[model samples]
Target: MRKNTFNIFSFDTTIRNPQRNIDFLQIIDKIDGKVLNEKSLLIYWYEAIGKGIYRPQNINAEIRNKLLKGESLSESEIKRIMQDNPQKVQNGFEGRAITHFKALHSQLLLIYDSQSKVVRISKLGRELLNHPYDVQNIYTKILLGIHFGSPIRKENNRARVFLNTIFVIDLLKREWGKLEKESKGILRHECVFVLGIKDCDYTKCVSEILTYREMYGLKENREYIENYCVSNDLKHLKYDTIKTYVDEVFRKFAMSGLIIARHNYYDFSSFESKKIEAILQHYKDYTFMEFSDIYEYIDFAYNITLPWIENNEVRKQIATQKAKELHISLQDLDFNDLTLLENKLNQTFYQQALKSKIEVSQIDTLLNELRILASGAQEKSSLDNIPEPLRLEYLLALILGKKYGSKNLESNLIYNENGEPLSYAPAGKADLLYENFSFEATMIKNRNQQLNSETTSVARHFYESKKQNTLEQRAMLIAPYIHWDVALFFKFCAKEFDSKLAPISISSFITLIEKSATFSEFSTNFDRLFVDKLLRDKTDAYVDSVNFVR
Candidate 1:
């Protein structure tokens, strides 16, 4: 007897036979029968929702139609028809079943994917007329709660029922396909209520959920295929290949309402509700994995899903709704956790660089880092001269690298109009000019002079030639350092380059030599400079000490 049956409905029962000759009256008698009514609808709902047994479809349709038609029942028509059970309230059995699964009944009637087509009773429901109670019904409340994607209501309520449905279905299906004992092979999809690609035939209805980018509408089932690709790590698969795969499974089985709402992809939102659902479903198995582990997984999957959902207006609305409930605002949040001021500064600096505008935020971040380095000096009491100069040089080096987009020390240049070379300069020559004189290289070169020569000169010379040919004259005539002597070196370099029509900055130095790439390149050179100066001063101090002893 190769008879097929639903998971909870079986035909091998005494009450419902193929002949339909059984005494319907006697059957109702044993159950303390009562006339069917809205309450009975609850009982049938319990059987279908709680036990996975399909309720009689015709009966529901009859009730709805009657209610709509406003047909009133006679006193006799409303009473139990069972001759022996006129006294019974449709039998205690009927009442108990309804009461026991009240939670399941409430949820499905309320929010069962209002979009799905109306369903009717299957032949299997008829077969279960007198079947024994099934235990799978126990998990219904839990699965329903999960499926509904709602918060858990107080004990054994509608929300609980929805979650229970999701839980059981997920466990029974084991990730909607082949079950893996290790559980690691299961594809983790980050979504809210997404349909599966396996349910749609892309070849025929490809534009089902076409998005903004895939505007061609070639074969995008909009929601399902994208989620499927994300869950299954099939991102590398070609478009047609994925479309073909989606067509095979989900073509007819559309009862599953797996669509979920999320913020603009993963990176744009803080916490996804679907992540919480996943944890609830798989928490026991993931206990040992750190919280960060799950967080990372959710984040990675979410970012990948961004391109598909970012432009979705409805998805954004839903994401916003969920975020509000969780007390998070997606608009002003970022992954870096930067303060408003800090963020503004960082962004301003980047914009300034892009648009060729000089800025000082680079100056601030560098100064902050320097303050940190200075505060951490190993010998605070000793207060060595090398430390402060080294910090200053290093700080200037970073500023130059950030401002000029080059970090190499050798790229910094200096020259005169007469083709004479000058001496070494700081890496952040541009920043120095902007800060010291509140103007760029051109303005400063036009008005400022070295050693009170208050008027600009047109001496044409390169740093190399000036230092080699007229080093003494150029050094004496070079621009003055406003705050530090090290900064003056860069100013002199810029002024000299402009005089010779070279106009090269430290950035040019980097382009010239790729290896000595950033102001940090000058770290070694500065260190040498620092040590030489320190030794010279120390020698003078030693001689003074010797003279005092004599």
Candidate 2:
């Protein structure tokens, strides 16, 4: 028994390491006794041997003694025994050091190519040792197989990378699911309903791999064999055919993840997450060949297919409604129209404040000035621009200035080819900056609401030529919004230009409203009285505005 243990350990170690050592069939023959008889003992014995060989040789004397006594080893015992002498044997056993490197090499080849490895042994390999087969425990091993043994990439060959059979199987087992419990699984049905086979099979395979099952035996019927064949929907496929499908599925999944050939392990994991995200970001990323059938399957699994599938009556109704909205035939109303409608809707909301009697001419002027102020304020508010987070403060200043009036506020409007002020790249160019920014629009508005002429307007609008480079960087945009120390403010600019621009006091706001009879009346005067007043200050306050041109 001791000699047999040594031989089994030595043989398996050799077989596992090299590509051409142990004939896998021979190993199977040795272990395949009556399922419940000494063969079972043979299985356990081989298990012990396999465990002993790969395990670190650092066995503690106590645990070693315990294991030698034929006591069933606990996980801790196994671990301790392995750790004490943490090395695997290259050859010798019982002082007979075998130099049969070829035997080891052959064994590894069998392990790699054998059907048993794909079927029974791959599943049972974990049991051959005392190690627990959890996802994390085998993740490194699986990753190793993907990097070293996969057909995708050779050691350093620059070819299209292929995933190993194990990765292929895991991906399918985890990701694919049946369309419905009642719906039979068949290959032809997928090919038929899903539109094509190439991309669909891969998508289905991924879905299968990600799915969980309660019974291990389920693989025999649903996974390993196409036993769900009924009628002409699916004919039972040969092993090679199934293997081909599995291979294609894996290749497609890897391709979708951008796992080209010759990628290193670091490259594989480093970019895998982002690649997966890109694939999942849009439904369109999935190919019609791949997702068409799986779509039904997912719907069925979720119990949403009956209402959606068959003739897709619900879809038709949706299509009809969409067609009505576009005033076109159902066939003419494609997906792009929905996107166009969305853009139009957003634009409507943006124009909500524009629906005033404040003349179309005034609308353009107000919007241009607002854009200038808002853009500048946004740029200055960014931390990158001002070294702090004060976006709200800058925005508040712009908003209040526009609503009340500011003398310290200023702008250089950019005009387009048609001589219209452009919202984006203004026509020519203008660079304007406030020398003094001591304007409080809200305070001025409050004062002006009392209809007091005594409230001196100190608010000014300064203008200059547009800078060679606009504020494009996020840092530049984010800085001005942040809070800065008084010292930092002085360093950025002088204090002489920082005098208070008397914005409309709160009292003045009241007087302006009192002068208006309705919301419409208020809106009419708003652009001229408040917004225009603030905008005109751009010329009034800017000493540079008079001389600067595009």
Candidate 3:
């Protein structure tokens, strides 16, 4: 087995960059059963980023900084960087990309097939593929449940019954808060000596975590320890190595809504102590599933069934509502019930080939979600669990695909080998694909942000996408609100290139959706909105172009 080792000295940096976790899983899902070429993943990683679907953070620092400064690497030089160059195999893009991929594997978010020497997205990884809005809450529960002896991790045995060191911190925070009462929360420095050790004693983690605070008078901003003159800790525990993990865990704890991270201290959240007590009681009743093989374990961990990780009431409400709809009530369904999610809130919207699928029929159903999401009050709906932006992006793909005739429509969102959606639609590309038109959408609210970020990119992509087709083709940019000034900026692009491009507010787009049931009506209605209202009308029309969020 290719052991994914974890100890105090080693911490998964992937937790710090959760946006890219789905991005990573999207790529790994492609090469699930492929053999190792060492360079296979680097190729996929670079290609995805090159196409703009992957996060720019995937770029190696050496190349990213230079690219940001307007310098670029030659084609041959780029190829050379991808070759067999170093003993560590971590230079170039491989360094940043592989580090997170391996750590996520260790977290059981992925599965590495030992016999085949191939990596696959585990069940938990697929859960992330489905929902990412409250990712910190979901990840914390998974992190708390898994221990060294979990069936999936062979090398973590040295951790020896240490039930997720992060879980130990949860206990430490609760216990310390009781003793200190009105005092400040647990200090950062003490965690390195107490909870961060490789063999952290599960039974005594509380006492050890508490002992250091009492012994050293630890509190906020009092973490620096120096032998002579150094910001480093005096006893040489290499605080830098493990401190990021501590900070990240504390941050996740805060988001989990059980614990609160305040400045340099950790404490339980404002919710009554009963919430923490309930979590602990259920945690005690939890038992690790001991499957003989790795695949079975992956399937079990895929849908997080834990109920007490956060607000159990909220989870139960969501679960019950989901059950009521199907008329298939079950006695128990946790926070992330697959039945509630599965295809409902997929990160991607791509489906099987559009051939004879009559996908447009589904747009009626998707409009139900769009109505909730567009109102900016997702909390009251079934779509509440997903981020507003992702839900918007997914709905656009499905609704537009069905509306425009699925075969004629193409969505640029990132997907796996199966052509399913995986993450948010990336920039530098026309987000939605139609024959010859550069149609796109964004949930960005600020006027300046839209102008600075999308002005050139949208105009340029419109021109580029249209170059392969016709000048009669048009471009439309949709957002929650549009700035009059931003509308005028795109007008300049249209005038300069002798092309047709216009920006529309999401409210206007929603209006079109409500009015047009077919592609002909959808297309012609938007055409009138573009030309009749903004193109030939007085410039004052531009002022009202920016409307309230739909």
Whole-model lDDT, candidate 2?
0.28
| Per-prediction TM-score | 0.17, 0.17, 0.49
> Candidate 3 versus the native: TM-score?
0.49
What TM-score would you give candidate 2 relative to the actual structure?
A: 0.17
What's the CA error at residue 258 for candidate 3, in Å?
A: 4.1
On TM-score, the candidate that comes out on top is: 3
Indicate which candidate wins on lDDT: 3
Ranking by lDDT: 3, 2, 1
Alpha carbon deviation, residue 452, candidate 2 (Å): 40
Candidate achieving higher lDDT, 1 or 3: 3
Give the whole-model CA lDDT for all candidates, comma-separated: 0.27, 0.28, 0.55
Model 2: ten consecutive residues of lowest lDDT: 473-482
Q: How much is 121 displaced in model 3, in angstroms?
A: 1.2
Model 1, position 263: C-alpha lDDT score: 19
lDDT tens string, model 1, 78-116?
332222233223354344333322222222211111123
After superposition, the stretches of candidate 2 with alpha carbons farther than 4 Å from their true spots are 1-200, 206-210, 213-318, 321-529, 532-538, 542-550
Q: What is candidate 3's lDDT per residue for 1-550, written digit by digit as tens? A: 2244334433365545444466567667767657545667555654444323332423466765433222335555455444533324446555555565666776667766545656667667776776664454456555554544456555443342323343565666567567755544456665554333335355465665566556555652334332211322222345465576566554433434445555576655433234445555555544444566666655555555555445556445544453453344465434465534423322222333222233424666777777665444323655443345555666776777766666667665543222323344334577776666666676655556568776777888877776777436778887765676777887777777777678876667777877888777777787776644666765557646535432
**How displaced is residue 283 in candidate 2, in Å?**
13
